[model samples]
Target: MTERVTLITGASAGIGTELARVFASNGHRVALAARRADRLATLADEITAGGGAAPIVIACDLEQPDAGDKIAAALAAEGVEVEFVVNNAGFGLFGHAIKLDRDEQLGMLAVNIRALTDLSLRFSDHLIRHRGGILNVGSIASFLPGPGMAVYYASKAYVLSFSEALRGELAPHGVRVTALCPGPVPSEFQARAGFLPGVDSLVLNVSPADVALAGYRGLMANKRAVLPGVGIKIVPFLLRFFPRGFVLSVVGRYQLRKR
Candidate 1:
């Protein structure tokens, strides 16, 4: 049997960190990857203290084009065979597309789109060979358009679409692909996305641990998508029935800068 290792990206904080904890607590050896090496080390120590095997820490900046290759190389160097991958590394920018810094917007695309795709494809052979699976962190934003956070919304849309398609393609091969669409969670995402304080209250807040658990369960079940909260679960149905323009308008208003 192929060795099973769960590789979690963006493991330094927030949902990614929580996901790592969940997997580790379940007795899964995880490889934690993020730009924050120090934070990864701390998490590794915590997991170890909890009696889980010491996690492999890899400091990676997924924004670089070659990040997927580097991660593969690093894992191979450690003799870790990834049986499960959590593509939980992504960020967003809040603003009109034209108003946001071009480089920053592109950087968001690089991390949120390019890196995820690259990694998903990069490990496909291994996953299929081992009957492993992938869990992609999407968002409620994936269900509809956001006029203000245009690029971010579109990126998540891509995530949802890609994950669904990949799920269909991989299922016959015994590989599962699950898209985790979570509503607002108490995480660093909003702050890093440039939301002003209190903006996160625009939606119900669930804990990162809850989201991670939902994702883990859904992935194991091989579900196509996992919507964590009640509010989030209603999103797809609402989007299907709502008028597109009306939905876009509401999102525009919601994303408006608050004083």
Candidate 2:
């Protein structure tokens, strides 16, 4: 019989790395994917040492158009079928949309949007056969208008919406889909986005390990969405109390201050 494994992207660090550890600890053989081969190898070694199944490491940059195909091929070569998918690979830029490098923003979309959608859909047959699940990493930014990080926020919005719709469609097939929306966690994301966390981040931040455990539990319970921190859980509800224009202005000003 072919082995079954959980495929986690962005598994080299931050929330992604924590998710890998959480899933492995829970008895799922994992396949780790990221751009950093060295980091993935180190994580794989750690997982094996902890008594989890040795993880399959696929070093890949999700910005490539064929990234999904490449990942699928790698798994097929290993003779393992994907039983769960974690679309945790994503990044953002902090700037006015017009001021950011056009190509860079598009590359972000390629990874955050394109690769995510591709992987989520590509293994539908395997997921159905295994009665498995999907966990997508989104941000509380998914719920609001982000004037400063426009494209990144928009990409996360797509992730949330797509995950919800996919959950409904796959429910009858015994496949779970959950969007894990966290407020902010200290990670390389801030550095890459050129963002410096301020007071708001301090108030909303949740640790990556906590976020990962919440995500694993949420997915197992078949919840539609999981907001890790109490602060993050309240964001969507609070958004309902504000006018869109006012919210936009507030976010714009806050992001500007971070610059």
Candidate 3:
């Protein structure tokens, strides 16, 4: 019998890799997608050694316009029916929009916003039919404005908003949609985003495994939003009581402090 696979984007490392482990540990076959095929191959070997089925590795860059279509077609060719989808592949740029490379900022949008949306829509039909669901990886930055990292924060806001609306629409059809909002974690994100040295120690760094576990639980339980850390959970709640300008000012100062 063909195994129903859980497709996780950015599965080569960090939260995405941990998410794959979570699904596979619980007996779900996984399909790993990322630009790093070597890392995916290593992870697949580990999973198979631990007695889970070998994962299908699809190596492709999500920044391409037709990336989502390619992923869908690859799954079809392999006869792998994706029962779960985790849109965890995303990146951030840490700088003023005007000062940063416009193409790089736009590329972040391509992967974080456009790719996520396209993949979700492409797999929605299969999910609805198979009683499966989608888990989108958002960020606490989504709740407020970010000055230094404007585009990255705004992109995540779209993720959280879109996930919530989609959840409502899919609920009656037995398809679950969850948004996983995690704060700073010990991952490649900070490095890729160009955080200053020793900056991560300034704040609490949560583990990718913990975030993945929280996300998995929320996705299975059909929660609207999953905030992994307690400190992170209070952010969105408090933002509601403050004026928009005040909130923006606070967020901007925080971003400035990171520099």
Alpha carbon deviation, residue 24, candidate 1 (Å): 0.8
Best by TM-score: 2
Candidate number of the best lDDT: 2
Candidate 2 lDDT over residue span 67-123, tens digit each: 998899999999999999999999999999999999999999999999999999999
Write down the RMSD of candidate 2 (Cα, Å).
Answer: 0.6
Please give, for residues 1-259, the per-residue lDDT of candidate 1 as tens digits: 5467899999999999999999999989999989999999999999999999989888989999888888999898887688898999999988889988999999999999999999898888889888999999999889889887899999999999999999999999999999999888777888888776454455656789999999999999989999987766877887788889989888888788542
Q: Which residue pairs in candidate 2 have backbone atoms (N, alpha carbon, C) closer than 3 angstroms, thus clashing?
A: none
| Candidate 1 error regions (>4 Å) | 197-203, 257-259
TM per candidate comes to 0.96, 0.99, 0.96
Query: Candidate 1 has what TM-score?
Result: 0.96
Error of 2 at 209 (Å): 0.5
The backbone clash count of each candidate, in order, is 0, 0, 0
Model 3 over residues 134-247: C-alpha lDDT tens digits? 999999877878899999999999999999999999899899999999988888888999875354333545689999999999999999999987677877788888999998
lDDT of each: 0.90, 0.95, 0.90
Candidate 3, lDDT over the whole model: 0.90
